[model samples]
Target: MTSFSANLGFLWADRSLPAAIRAARANGFDAVECHWPYETPVLDVKAALEETGFKMLGLNTRRGDVSKGENGLAALPEREDEARAAIDEAIDYANRTDTAAIHVMAGKASGPKAQATFLKNLDYAVTRTSRTILIEPLNRHDAPGYFLKNTTQARDIITKLAAPNLKLMFDCYHVARNEGDVLFRLQDLLPIVGHIQIASVPDRRAPDHGELHYPTVFSKIADLGWKKPIGAEYKPVSATEEGLDWMNSHLC
Candidate 1:
């Protein structure tokens, strides 16, 4: 299997950012995926990484001030300005972290006008980054109105955007939740998927918690020549390290 990335955001949403980062490194993970590391200063993170030798595999664009009613770009009609700013922030963060990929975390889908604005905003962001921006789908159960909720819709959006600097972030949990044909759809979407993420279905626990066989899935990905890093984006049922016990046993 390829080197897996520890996602501090989902794994330790309740814990302090530095605590989560250190825990991932101590637990033997080689790299991390920072979702919004906005709460923790990058300087401290850099210092911790220098001490621990952990690398940042990727990062996501920070969403706008939600307290100000800017939930996301995909659903906001007049937030193109905020969306452009968010993309610039993500690019700067990626440059600092020395990573090439950035996940454009898609927000809710309000109406037709919102979609039009979302695509326009995405086009603007796409032009800013030489590296492709990843668009991820969140499950409907967790996000009732989230845009790009499945591979089919993500596929359509990416096709319509038609930007060389645009791709997909295929998360196994969301894929399993919305569409259970993980292997088949993976074959079809791999060309567009820049990064992959995994968690147990429904519960978002460690991969071994439920029936989604990550071994076969990962093996298939390996077979398909997907050489990029995959993020372990799961919510631990217990302590984060405790949940990753299966990784030491199953993932080599």
Candidate 2:
């Protein structure tokens, strides 16, 4: 039915994980996702999830050395050990928090070396955990030099790896910006897709202001038989709650 998941990463940066879960539940979100939850104790986040009955959709592995502009370690080649360690840490965190998936960032790597590293790390990741492991394609405009930059690349990697646990994190906003064939691409990629996220293209704001019509897209998702939560991964133009009228009417 295209249930909505609040992306606490963008939706409620001002609050703690527990508080954000409460806010998401109050706002009628069926589930919740986050970027990083390592700062907060897992018990508190788990307690909030239990209290709200909201699913913890997924979380990301830590972006290596944010100070040095390293986005992730998975594709760095030189950081293979660190990347595997990060994967193990993420699996532990997901298990502790009851998160269903883990989006392993590919960092700022490019070319064959990067691809090789990513493939090796992904192979290691799927072997270590039963939970879904996701690869998202960030738009070049928003994330220059990022290792993975398109759905096709992610799809190819997933295909080459042949890991049942590895899947795509299809962010509609990034796809639209990079490829622009949203509906058709969704049709092509839905089979291997594990999670879907949305935001206004160009502006990265709430979906209501986007070039894409989310209501239509949501309907299409339902028609395609997608049974997972559609992630609300957008920066609100104003207060996050103020921009949710569209979600309230459509998902809630």
Candidate 3:
């Protein structure tokens, strides 16, 4: 059977992190993931996870200043100190929350300088913790000027680093948008994928809609022998509960 992790960042936008974790448990999700939980008290989040018995599959490093439209710090040449600090903070949070991975966000900067900085930050990140460290490839459409925008680039970086702890965050929605061949890409890149996330393409809604056939995709993921939780990181078309009809249908 395919396992799903409710992305608390999207599912219960109006609720507190603890409440969102409780809701994910109630809603039949196998686990939960977060984009950023630094705003919440770690103990409170930890208590909720303990009570609910749901593992937080992963979370993200900070996105720097939202006011400045900074998507991440790791890839910015000038923000190396801040990037390292964000990594440390994420590691500390993951340790406290029992998260298995951290998606290190690469900010909206590109070029040799940015790449060098990202590699440096990644090198720093890998030595700090035993947990998986993920680098996601955001689509250019959604994240213009983003430093990391494709799986090929991410895969190459992972191969170059050769750090067992460093891996790719394969977000299907972004991949589908930027690369088009979701199943083929999934198969080709499964080796380096530390985590997988999903949403409908073009619309970024529930996986049941849009061009991607999620049932087939889910089956493909299973066939690939992926044991990690697949994150449902989509915006709800309606209320969170109401948009889960597709998931309910697949619960056999």
TM-score of each: 0.90, 0.97, 0.98
Candidate with best TM-score: 3
> What is the lDDT, from 0 to 100, of the residue 14 in candidate 1?
75
TM-score of 3: 0.98
Better of 1 and 3 by TM-score: 3
lDDT of 1 by residue, 62-144 (tens): 66666754445644677667777788888887766565688876576666786687788788778877876888877778777
Kindly list the per-residue Cα lDDT of model 2 for residues 1-252, writing each as its tens digit.
568899999998899999999999998889999998999999999999999998899999989999988888899988998999899999999999889999999999888999999999999999999999999998989889999989889999999999999999999999999999899999999999999999887898988766988888888898999988899999987787888887767543
Name the runs in model 3 displaced over 4 angstroms: none
Q: What C-alpha root-mean-square deviation, in Å, does candidate 1 show against the real structure?
A: 2.2
C-alpha lDDT of residue 246 in model 3: 75
Report how far residue 191 has shifted in candidate 2, in Å.
Answer: 0.7
After superposition, candidate 2 runs with Cα above 4 Å error: none
RMSD after Cα superposition, model 3: 1.0
Instruction: Estimate, for each residue in 167-224, the C-alpha lDDT of model 3 and write its tens digit.
Output: 9999999999998999999999988988899999889998887899888898899989
Best by lDDT: 3
**C-alpha lDDT of candidate 3 relative to the true structure:** 0.92
